[model samples]
Target: MWFKNLQIFQLKDTENFSSTDLVTKLPDHPLRECGSQDEFTFGWLPLIRNSEQWSISSDLCMLVRAGKEEKVLPTAVVREELEAKVAEIELVEGRKVGRKEKADLKEELVFSLRPKAFAKRSDIWAYIDLKAKLLVLNSTNAGMTEQLFKLLQTTLGSFPMVPLQATVSPSSIMTDWLVKNDVPASLETGDEVEIQDASEDRAKIRFKSLEPLSEDVTRHLEQGMSVKNLALRWTDKMSFVLNDDLTLKKVKFDDTLKDNAFNDSQGGALSDMDANFALMSLTVRDFFESYKVWFEIQDED
Candidate 1:
């Protein structure tokens, strides 16, 4: 599946990574169903839709998925049940329930209700680009990404990586691009932008479906606002919102890219998947190579 957002990481010690290594280790942490009293469970899942293969390699890129299962117990329902129990106890004893006793009652009630709670499962996709020495995840949330990193580390025995950061802040470069209307030739500015004040007030202004370089936007730039997020189209291949933290949000590939991949597929499901992944990974590789210079990404020795 195509990733809708991007969280990039620079993979150190990439020489030690291989598809075989990941495939061998994935079984150690296969996704398990949540237990009755367990709040959540985290583990690995097969990357392909109908295949047991946990790793798919295409054009030097390898894809894997992390699965999470969480119990869903509505807070309102728990509160209602707890209140009814507390009320019944007060009526029977003709006295108010103590705070400690009420806490214990809520705990007992939750444990009892845990088995009936619905379970929700979600899959997170990620890929490792061997050529680029990059690990890209389909998530922008720090906590969720950290969970994946932890799982990978535990499974593989070692996962040396760090979040990608530029020598100059992304916001600083984005702000300059907006102020000068001199974005890189390979990239085009889109209609949406978010600007925030550098001062302590931290006021933010969001503009969507409007000209990002219009006079209104210029006025904000003149008044000490800087670009915190900017929408960008990457050489007619894909579009995404580039954030100050270097995460990409709302990433969408062009129909032509999808069409080409489809046309190249061999009419088999597995062939179709391989073709799609090959195209996506190659396109992303080109995109990173095109813009990484601006970010001044340093290679690990």
Candidate 2:
């Protein structure tokens, strides 16, 4: 039920700015309405495009009370003005190419955690009533569906007075593995192989690519030389700033740089490599961190 009735704001033109200004302005907002409970409030500034005229945006989501009336006051107005002022400064400094424009301004003022709440209730019979609806509307795989059912069971199990009726489906992975690897019995050329009992032996696997590994973790792995310290070192240097998913979202090799790599016959052209590394490092570092929390969670688990 956390983050229920949260207020989220999208600043359509101030995505590349630091959070210092916003953090300073937070105390002016109606914090009393957010309640005394522990909550999360964060912002993300994304540089959507770069050119003579650049486009930037920010996402600001806050967790607050359900019944609270959201406030739009002089402070909010000042915050907006401050963001515009910062953008102007960036443009003047050549940090940003041109004037920033606000586009696709959308405000979803009233939101609730209804979906998560429903999945956490003790009313499985009521949940079953929604299964058909979910199958029609949700895009979840069977594995995810089973996971949800299990989560619901664990949630409702504590409430013994309530009877649960939801049925858990078999995991999709069980079916997927069978379909992918199961040999057809109708195959004529294959030799008959004897079935063997499964063993607990685990195989050590190493991945090697002829092409350069283009991921932050890959770069760290290639540079760190220690698998045991890779996660910790990468986290220290790149955590909260790089995202692996987004880094590999698009694999673009600089052909120009590649050509230059071969063209420079003068054996000591390390500057080009240095510059390329720096640019690639910065781009991957910034865009990837936006979704790095998922990687952090995986590591922790």
TM-score of each: 0.93, 0.16
Residue 285 of model 1, lDDT score: 88
Q: Scored by CA lDDT, what does every candidate get?
A: 0.88, 0.24
Q: Give the Cα error of residue 82 in candidate 2, in Å.
A: 78
Judged by lDDT against the true structure, how good is candidate 1? 0.88
Question: Model 2: runs farther than 4 Å from truth?
Answer: 1-199, 203-268, 297-301
Clashes of 2: 4
Local accuracy of candidate 2 as per-residue lDDT tens digits, 1-301: 1000111111221233333443333234311322222122111111111211111111221111101112223445544755665577577876743333322111211121211111111110111111111111021233433433343234333211121111321112112212243212221111111111123542222323221122422343333221211010122122111111111111333455345444543443333433443333333333233322322212111
How many angstroms is residue 184 displaced in model 1 relative to the true structure, after the best TM-score fit?
Answer: 1.1
* Candidate 1: residue pairs that collide: none
Please state every model's RMSD to the true fold in angstroms.
1.9, 25.7
lDDT of 1 at 43: 94
TM-score between candidate 1 and the true structure: 0.93
Alpha-carbon runs more than 4 Å astray in model 1: 89-103, 199-201
